[model samples]
Target: MVSVRRVLSILFCLLMAGLVSSLAVGYFSADGIQWIDAVRIVLLAASTGWLAWGAAYAFNGLLSLPLKREDKTFELVPTSARTAVLVPVYNEDPVKTFSHVAAMIGSLHALGVAGRFDFAILSDTRDPEVAEKEERWFQRLQLECGAHTDIFYRRREQNTGKKAGNVADFIRTSGALYEYMIVLDADSLMEGATMAEMVRRMDDDPRLGLLQTLPKIVHARSFFGRAMQFSTGYYSPIYTRGLAALQGTAGPFWGHNAIVRTRAFAQSCGLPELSGRPPFGGHILSHDYVEAALLTRNGWTVRVDPDLTGSYEEGPDNVVDFAKRDRRWCQGNLQHGRVMVAPGLKPWSRFVFVQNIMAYVASPLWALFIIASIAAPTLKGVPDYFPEPGLSAVFPRVEQGLALTLLVGVFGLLIGPKLLIVARGAISGVNETFGGTGRALLNTLTEILSTSLLAPIMLMYQCRAVLEVFFGMDGGWPATDREAGSVSLSEAWSASWWISATGLVTLGLAFQFAPEYVGWLLLVAGPQVFAPILIHVSSRSALGTAEAGLFETADDRNPSPVVLRQEAILAHWRGAEASAPAFRPVPEPAFEAADAER
Candidate 1:
C-alpha cells in the first residue's frame, strides 16, 4: 500500500497532467490535426504537464508552511558522538577553499561546540601545482586555527572515482572514528549553530540517515549570478517545502551541505561502476541521489529541512558557467536510467529518479515539439476542418480559441506559482525579505524578463547536452570558472555562434513556410540572434545596478553573521600575502601523533 503523502502527490500530478492533456487535445483537434500536429500536441502536453506538476508542488508548499512541524531544538547538550566536517576539493582555488574552512571553524568555535567536530580537507586534485597550493593553504589554515581545532589534510595520488571515490576513501580509512559526517563542497558554508543542530537531530533520531539543508546562494555579484541568487532565496524554499511534504521520509541528498550517518552510508551507499563507457556507465556522476535511494532501500530516512537557515553556497557567475555545470548534470541525471531499476528501491525513490531524468529530457522534447511545429506546415497541406461524409458534420473552424487557452495555461504554469508566492508573502508580511513590496515586484519582473531571454539559450544548450550524451560524449569534471569577469561580445559570440545560426535558419524557415508563426518564433529565435549581447550584458558586474534594486535578496540587504564572517575571512586572506609562509610539509611524526591522539 502506498502512503498518503505519495498518493496525494501522485493524484496532484495526475490531475495536472489530465488537465494539460485535455487542453492540448482540444486545441489540436479543433482544426482537424494532422499526424505531425498530433505529435506536437503530445510533446507539448507532456513537457508542459511536467512543468505544471512542479508548480503544483510549490503551491502545496505554500499551503503546508503554516502546518509544518518543528524538529527537536539543539540546546547544547553534551554530545558523545563525533562528527567529521568533510570538505572535498577538486582543482579549485585553495585560498578561497581554505578561507571558507577558516570561517566555518571560527563560527563553530564561537558556538563552543567545536570540540565535538573535526575538519578534514579531502583533496582529489590531480594538478600538481594545485595540490601544492592546497598543501600550503592547509599549513596556513592549521597555523591560524590549529590551537583550538582539529584539522587534517590528505591528498590522493590518483583521483580514481572523482568526488564519490574520494569520499569512499575517507570512509574506508577514518569513517570509523565519526558517528556522523557533514559533507561540504569547496564553495559550501554552513553556520555553526545549524551544524550543531543538525548533529543533535541526527543523534536524536537513529532512523535518520541523512539531513539535507536548503543552501541559499550568496556572494553573487554578476547580474546573472545575483538573479540566480535572488530566485534561489525567494522561490526555492516553497519548492523545497513542497518537496519535503511529498517526500516524507524519503528526501533528497544534494551531495553537499548535508549530514549523513557514517554507518548507514558505509553499509548501503557503496556505489558500483556501471557496465559501459562514458555518459551512461562507469562511475555515477550524480551519486548523491543514488545514495539517498540506497539509504531508503536499507530502511534509513533521508530528510530535507527547509526551515533550517544559514546553509549557503556560491553559484556560477554567468550563463556560460551555468551551462558548463548543466552539461555535466545532464549526463549524470540521464545515467540514472540504469540505477532506476536497481533492487529494493522504494517507489518514491524510483519516481524521484524519473523526475530528475525528465528535468533534462523535457528540454529536448520541447525543442523537438517546436521543430516539428515549424516543419509541419511545409510537410502537409492545410487540413480540412469539415467532418468526413460518414461523420457528423461540424462547421469548419480554426482552433484559435483553444490554442489561445493552451497558451494561457502554459503561461500560467510558468508564472502563476511566482505570483502566488508574492501574494502569500504580502499576506504574511514576509515581503521585506525581498527588500519590500515594490522592490520585490520590480525584481520579480526583472527575473522573469531575464530568465525569459535566457530560456531559449538554455534550452538549446540542454538539447545539445542531451544529444552529445546520447552520442557517448562525456563531459569530464572541469574546474568551474567562478571568477571570470565580464564576458566580451566576441567571447560570447564564439561560444554561441551555433545558436545564432540555428536561430537564423529557424526564423528563415518560419518566414518561408509558416509566416503566421513568425511572432511566436521570435520568442525562441530573438534571444539566440542576440545571444552575444545577452550573454555579455548579463555577465557584466555593473549589470547588478542598485537604482531599481534588482535582484536584492534578504542575504544581500541584511547579511547573516556567518556570511559577514566569511566575507571578512576571505578579505583578510586575500589581503595578507606576507602573514603566511610558503608551502612546507608537516613532519611524519606530527601526523602520527595527531592520528594516535584520535
Candidate 2:
C-alpha cells in the first residue's frame, strides 16, 4: 500500500511536470508538432521533473517542523551490550583523524559509558610514511584517552574493497566480539550524549538494523565550504526532517556517522563486487545506499533520526575538489541501475536508487534540454499560414502569456522554497539564532545567487562525468584531498578551461542560430564562461570569513563540546608537530538533496 505522503509526492511531481511540459508543447508546437518540439518538451519535463522533485522535498521541509528531539532519561549500564566505534581511514591525515577519534573517546568517557564502547582505528593507508604516522597517532590517541583495553588499531595491507571492505574485514575477524558497530569517517565526531541516545533508539527497536545521523559540516574555511557549512546548519535540518518523514523503514546510510548491528550487517551486507572492472563493476563506490537497501531487503529496518545532534563531518573546501568527489559518486550512482533490480527489494528502495541516479543524471538532462531548445527554432522549418489564396498570414500563435507563465514556473521552482523557508523563519523568530532576520534573509539570497551561478559550472562537470561513465570510462576510486589550499587562477583555468570554451561556443551558436533564446542561453551558459574565476574566488578562505560572519551558523558561533574538543586536540597536536611522527591514498570518497548536501 502506497502511503499518503508518498502519493502526495508522486502526484505533485506528475502534475508539475505535466503543467510545464504542456505549456512547452503549446509554445513550441503552436504551428505544428515537430520532432524537435517533442524532444524539447520531453527534455523540459524530465529536467523540470527533477527540479520539482527537489522543490517537493524543500516544500515538505518548510511545512514540517524539525523532528522532535528524544529525551535521554535512561542510561546505559556497564553490563550493556558492547558496541565498537569504527573509524575507517585510507591515506588520510593522521593527527587530524586521530584527534577526532580521541575526542570521541573523551566524550564517551565523560559519560562514564566508555566501558560499554570500544574504539577501533581501521586503516587502509597504503603509503608507508602515512601508515607509520597512523600507527604513531593510534598510540598517542590511546595514551590520550587511556583506553588501553577498549581502544584497538589495525591496518589492512590490502585495501581491496576500500572503506566497505575495510569494515567488512573488521566484522569478519571480530564480528562475535560486539553486538553493534558505529561506523564513522576519518573526520566524523559525535558527542557522548548523542552516541548514548543512538544506542537507546536501537535498543528500543529490535528490528532496527541501522541508525543514521544528520552530520553537520565543520571546519569549512572557504567561500564554497562556508556556504556548504551554512546550508548544512540552516537548511539541512529541515531537509533532513523532510527526509526522515519520507524514509519510513528504508533510510539513508551516508557511509559514515551511522550505527549498524554488527551481526546483521555482516550477514546482510556482504557486498559482491560487480562482475566488471571499474566504475560500473568491481567494488561499489556508493556502498552506503546499497547497504541500506540490502538491510531493508532482509526485513531489517534502516532509519535516519534527524533530531540526533552532535554528529559532524568535513567537506571539500573548493569547487575542483568537490567536482572530483562527485565524479566518483556519479559512477557509483550510475552503477545502482544494476542493484535497483535486485530480488525482493521494497518499491521505495527501488525509487530511492532511481532518485540517487537522477542526482547526477539531471545535469546532462538539463544540458540536453538547452541544446534541443536552441536547435528547435531552426528545425521547425517554415510555418504556413496562408494555405489557400487570400488567407490571412498568421504570426504562429506564440502564446506569450503561457510562455511567461512557464518561465515563471520554472524559476519559482528553483527559488520559491528558499523564499518560503526564509519567510517561515522570519515568522518563527528562527532568524534570531541566525544573526537576526535581516542577515538571514540577506544570506539566503546570497546563497541562492551563488549556488545558481555554480550550478551551471557543476552541471558541465557532471555532464562530462556521466558521458565518461556511459562510454566505459571507469573513474577509479581516488583519495579525497581533504587538505587542499586556495585554488590559484592558473589551477582553476587548467581545470575549467574546457568548461569556459564549451560555454563560449554554446553561447555563440545559440545567438547565431537561434537569436530568440539569447537571453535564456546567457543564463544557462554564462556562468560556465566565468567558471575559472568563480572557482578561484570561491576557493579562497579569507573571503569566506570577511563578510562580517554572513555565512556563520549557530554551530560556528558556539560549537558543540565535541567540535570544540576536536579543535583543542588539533591545536595541541600542531604545537607538538616537531615531536610528532609524520604520515601520508585510499579512494577517499549530493543534491538535489544529493548526499544530504552536507
Candidate 3:
C-alpha cells in the first residue's frame, strides 16, 4: 500500500536533502572549473544558489505572517528623540519634488510634532542648469516650509558615491544631529502620521537600525502604466514581508523609502568603493545590501514593515522607460559580486548580496539554459551524462526526477510568492487594493502573459546593460523624461532586434528538433524576445499626446513646461502673422535689488 501522505513527506525530505547536497557540492566545486566551463558551471552552481534564495524568500514570508493581521494598529505617537528625513535627489524636476516635500511638511506642522523632525534635501545633481534650478527651488521651499521644518539642502562638489556617496556624505556631516533618518527618493512621498509611526517603532526597539515601509505605487495611467501600477500594488508588499521575515535582524536595505538610525548608519553604512572600474569600479551600484550587511555586522537589526502604510512612490511609465531604469539597476546589482567575499561580512549579508546578483544574472543564465536544452536534442556528441548515486534501478529515475525538482525550484521562487500573497489577500479580505478579487485574478493572468513577453525583452536589455557596465559604460542615475506619444516601428525594431532574433532562433530550433519543449520556452519568453518591436511600436502612439500618459499626474496637477513652451512658440507665431511681436519678456531686476533681496 502506498501511504499517500507518508510517501509525500518522505519524498519532500529527500528532495530537500538532495538540493542541499547539490548546492554544497556546487559552491565548493565552482573553484575547480576552467574558463570554457564558466558559463556551464555558473548555471549549475546557480541552480543551488537560487534555491537557497527561494528558501530565504519563503522564510521571509513566514516571518512577516504576523504582519498580515487585519486588526493590527501601529504606535503613531512621536517620541522625545529627534528624527531626520533625508530626501535624496539626482537631476529630477525640483518644482514637483518641492511640492511633495511641502505637502508633507504641512502635514507634519499640523500634527504639532514638526519641531521634533528635520528635513534635508540631499542633492547629487551636477548639471549646471539643473543644479542652479534646484538651488533656486530650495530657496523658495525653505521660505515656505521652514516654519515647521528645519529644512536644509546639500550638494556634493564631487558626486563620488552617486546615491550611496550622497547619503554617506550626509551622515558624515549632519548625522550627529538626529536620532533617526528617513530616506526618501525625489519621487517618494510619505504621510506624516506614518513617518511618526516609523520613528516610534525605532524608538521602541533599540535594536532596530532600519524599518522600511511599503510604498504605494502612484502616478500611472497608460495600459503599460496600469500594468506596473497593478503589479506593484499586488506583489511588492508580500514580497517585502517575506524578505523582512527571513531577514529578522539581517534584513536587506533598499536605499530609499525607509528609515535608518543616524548613529548606526554613520558607523556601519559608509560604503567602501570596490577596487575596479566602470560597472564594478569606484562604487557599488547597489549599496543597500552592503549597508544592511554592515549594520547587521555591528549587531543592529534591519527590518521591513510591510504593514506600514501611507508611503508612496512612482513607477516608470512604459516598457522603454522601465528598460532605462533597469540599465542602471543591472550595473548596480552586478557590482555585488565583489562585496559578497569582502572581509567581516555577516551570514545574512552574503545572502542579500546573492539575491541582488541573481535578479540580473538569472535572466541570462535562463537564456543560456534554454539554448543548451534545445541543442541537447540534436547534437550527438553533446554531454547528457547524469551522475549515478549508486542505486541501480532508481538511478536514472532519481537523477531525472532530481533534475526536474531542481528546475521547478526556480519557478517556485518566482511564482510561489505571488500565489501565496494572492491567497493571503483573499483570505484576509484585503483584495480591494487591486479593485477586488475579480480584478486581481484578471490582472494576475494578464501580468503572467505580458511578463512572459517582457522576460525576453528584459533578458536582452539586462544583458546589454550588464555588458555595457562590464565594458566601461557608465549608467549614472539620470532622471527619466519619457516622451509622450508613439515610437516608430523602426525605433522599436532597432532597440529590440537582438532579443527578437534570439527568440526567433530559439523558436526555429525548438520546432526543428525539440518539438516537445521548444513551445514551452517560446511561450514563456516569446513576447519578451519581440518586446522592442511589439511593445515599443504599439506604445509609441500612446506616448506623445494624452495617450502617452506618463506625465499625466504632473500635468493634471501642475502646468508642464512642455505645454507652456509650446503655447509660447505658437503665440509668437500668431503675433508675427499679425505684424506685431509677442509680449516682451519680463525685464531682469537691477543688480542692486537682487543683492538686497539676497
Clashes of each: 0, 5, 19
RMSD of each: 5.7, 5.7, 10.0
lDDT of each: 0.83, 0.82, 0.65
Q: Write the per-residue lDDT of candidate 1 for residues 481-568, one digit (tens) a residue.
A: 3345567777787778888889899899899987767887898899988887898889988443843577888776666666766666
The TM-score values for the models, in the order shown, are 0.92, 0.92, 0.76
Cα RMSD for predicted model 2: 5.7
lDDT of 2 by residue, 34-110 (tens): 89888888889988888888888887777775333233243553447788999999899999998888777766766
Report the backbone clash tally of model 2: 5
Task: Output the lDDT of residue 551, model 3.
Answer: 21
Clashes of 1: 0
Q: What is the per-residue lDDT of model 3 for residues 1-598, given as tens digits with 9 covering 90 to 100?
A: 1134224433543565456446433432322323333444456555545654554454455445454446344455747888888888888977667666766675566557788889999888878898998887677678666878799898888888788888888888888888999998987777666788888889889999988787766655455665665666667666666555455577767778899998988888887776766667777777887888888889998888877776777776566667878887887788888888888887658867876888887766766757765664454233324435564432111233444565576556556656666677677665654455665666576666566556667677777777676777764332433465344556666566666777777788888876656646766557856666666643543234333332232223332222222233334333543564433321223212322321
lDDT, residue 413, model 3: 54
Clashing residue pairs for model 1:
none
Candidates sorted by TM-score, descending order? 2, 1, 3
Better of 1 and 3 by lDDT: 1
Ranking by lDDT: 1, 2, 3
